[model samples]
Target: MSDPRVAEHMPLLSKKWDTDVAKKFIASKEQRWARDGLGHWAFLVDGRYVGWGGFQKEGDEWDFGLVLRPDAFGLGLRITREAIEFAIADDRIPFVTFLLPPSRKNLSALQRLGARHFGEVNYDGARFLRYRLETR
Candidate 1:
């Protein structure tokens, strides 16, 4: 996760990373991915890590997202499509929510995936638009 290029798109992350901090972040993600197969997974292309996408569950809410490098922006819609498909395939996931900053408004993509705007939320001092897609 130390790749600065990839972190450019994450709106909530405001600080730069040091070596130790980066290692800890990676370790934390590894632990989560190992625990439930629900944490973020690296988006790789031709063996290169271009971005990441996955879900995180908090109580009954499942928040999901995909962050990709600037050069990989074109892949965003495709990733969104796949994420929706993944959610529909898993019966355990009753629904999936997406959190995005006000600046990154891409509601059309959500509409295309049948996601409805749930509302807005403030997290870590930043406001985000929340959208949800239900499988049932």
Candidate 2:
């Protein structure tokens, strides 16, 4: 996204948001779907694009992530719950990992959802706090 606020805590996002970057991002998500049978999703509310996020297989674990617009921030927990429910139904996803930026202070919602802090991880040179939630 071009919005700096959206990228503030996102580490893998190295490039500035532009037409080329947006296209590549979409293409990459599509590639994931083709190869892994699952990938990111575009989330909408009231017929409007709110944000996009979903599952991506990493190594032997399935990671879950969500990035919502600033205006839709309040809906994060609800959206995440719905996504996790989807994971629960899918036999392939035994667990879901969440990598949150350390800058995020209010993580009570994730804990309320039964997610436990796994540890810290360095992803593409970016440090993040990892959390795991078992779907089974």
Candidate 3:
């Protein structure tokens, strides 16, 4: 998503159950994040927007995040994996991390992508498990 459009979708993308807080974070920072040509991209399938996934700076490392419309959740993981691969192509990104809330469903999907738990962090009153996909 481009800057203004992403900002406009922030609330809808932030829906707790249907989406994820990470989506909202991206939307909120759309302008600053996209200036570098590295930021969230809305995932489109069959010409419809399924969700978004891409690269963003997190702490000291480049991390990735994604979320899909509730109806598109299952297929969304595939899109996320592809996005991760794209992000890894950039030499600036040594490792890409996924921060997931403690949900069995999400954890299972993440594992299927070969992501390994690397750490955890508490943010926005929620705890997130950090999974890393090494690019080196």
Candidate 4:
């Protein structure tokens, strides 16, 4: 979260991520993933961490999420595609959802991946556009 490029897009998380805070946040997510079998993973390229991609349950839907550093921008589409394909192949995941802020101007890219806008939601005092992707 300290990465300026990454923090620029994540307004909510940017302000509070010191070492302890970040560690706790990661631990909480890891715990949730371990217990629910739904969570994201670090995106690595040749052993270098570039970003993260994974799922989180939100209102009975498994929401897919992705985040990449500015230097890794071009790799986002490919990584997202692979993550979607993985989700599709997992029979347990009926569909995937997404909650993106307006600042995330990747609607076209998401559309290309078969995500359709479902609605909007107010989460944690912030608004997000919701989307869904199901097996074709």
lDDT of each: 0.78, 0.92, 0.69, 0.82
- Sorted by TM-score (best first), the order is 2, 4, 1, 3
- Model 3 clash pairs are none
The 10-residue segment of model 1 with minimum total lDDT is 1-10
Worst 10 residues of 3 by lDDT: 9-18
Off by over 4 Å in 3: 1-27, 104-106
TM-score per model over all chains: 0.84, 0.97, 0.72, 0.91
Model 3, residue 57: C-alpha shift (Å): 0.6
Clashes of each: 0, 0, 0, 0
RMSD of each: 2.4, 0.8, 6.7, 1.5
lDDT of 4 by residue, 5-45 (tens): 77766646745669899788899889978877878899999
lDDT winner, 2 or 4: 2
Clashing residue pairs in candidate 4 (N, C-alpha, C atoms within 3 angstroms): none
Best by lDDT: 2
lDDT of candidate 2 over 1-136, digit per residue (tens): 6677788878788988889999999999999999899999989999999899999998989999899888888989999999999999999999999999998889999999999999999998889999999999
Between candidates 3 and 4, name the one with more favorable TM-score: 4
Q: What TM-score quantifies how close candidate 2 is to the native fold? A: 0.97
* lDDT (C-alpha) at residue 131 in model 1: 88
